[model samples]
Target: MSFDKIRDPRKIRHQIGDMECDYIYTAGVAGERFYIALRDEEKLLATRCEKCNITFMPPRLYCDNCFTELASFMEVPSKGVIESYTITYFDRDGQALPEPEILAFVKIDKTDGGLIHRIGEIKPESLKIGSKVTAVFEAKKERKGALTDIKYFKPA
Candidate 1:
């Protein structure tokens, strides 16, 4: 039966058993390059759109403004200022965490965009909107091509 003609609720068929499915996700061209730099070189990469004169963190393949292909990739300083932040006392499951975790949206120097990551090495009371922070990466031996590769951002 075609779903296009369906009008009655009783005509719908339902399955109760769980469906098994598996999938893998790739970061795509621009993201792959970004991750590689972050993992292998411990560098923060940003893509610039010459047309719009805008730089994007977590680099993009194209510019959102001019729709120009972003061919220029550059390393942005790992240090940045906290534009905004929050302290979460509960975990993802809503359970109370032993210690509150600080998360911030940091505007990296010389870039139009920034990264949102956990802020560490400082008390929540001390954090401010303009606080200077730096990315703390995982040890070289433990580096991985993922956002988690950055342990957290700390006061610089």
Candidate 2:
């Protein structure tokens, strides 16, 4: 290509197009059941692998350990231990938040999978790695089929 062709402003133009796709998302087998339990029953359900004797939170249809099809649904205690945590002071858009929010990875007892949620009603300095906590669900009538069903995890 010649330099004249490369430098021509008329040859260059910005093209814009909208990128969009729409679809209804159905939570797979395990998630659907778990969400229903949270919304209607106010219960935390876990799937246990009878063969390997492993329990999974958020109820998996298959076992990660033995790869067995998990069908045993059990209610696990809402109590958990904080595996890790962070205190965030800013919003996603880089604006300062009115107050810092404590986010944590809480590993519910006797289950493999854990929940990631906000920690409340406690000071940041008092938060510990193994702090005992429990899932706090929103009011029954206020619940929606989502992770926000449990508003936050607080000290047990």
Provide the overall lDDT of each model, using Cα atoms, as 2-decimal numbers. 0.91, 0.89
Deviation from native of the Cα of residue 114 in model 1, angstroms = 0.7
**Residue 1's lDDT in candidate 1:** 58
Residue 21 in candidate 1, Cα distance off native in Å = 3.4
State which candidate has the highest lDDT: 1
1-156 per-residue lDDT for model 2 (tens digits): 455657656576756678899999998999999999899988899999877877888789998877888876889998799999999999999999999999999999988779889998899999999999988889999999788999999999
How much lDDT does candidate 2 score?
A: 0.89
Per-prediction TM-score: 0.86, 0.87
Q: In model 2, where do residues sit more than 4 Å from their true spots?
A: 1-12
How many times do residue backbones clash in model 1?
0
Worst 10 residues of 1 by lDDT: 7-16
Relative to the true structure, candidate 2 reaches a TM of 0.87
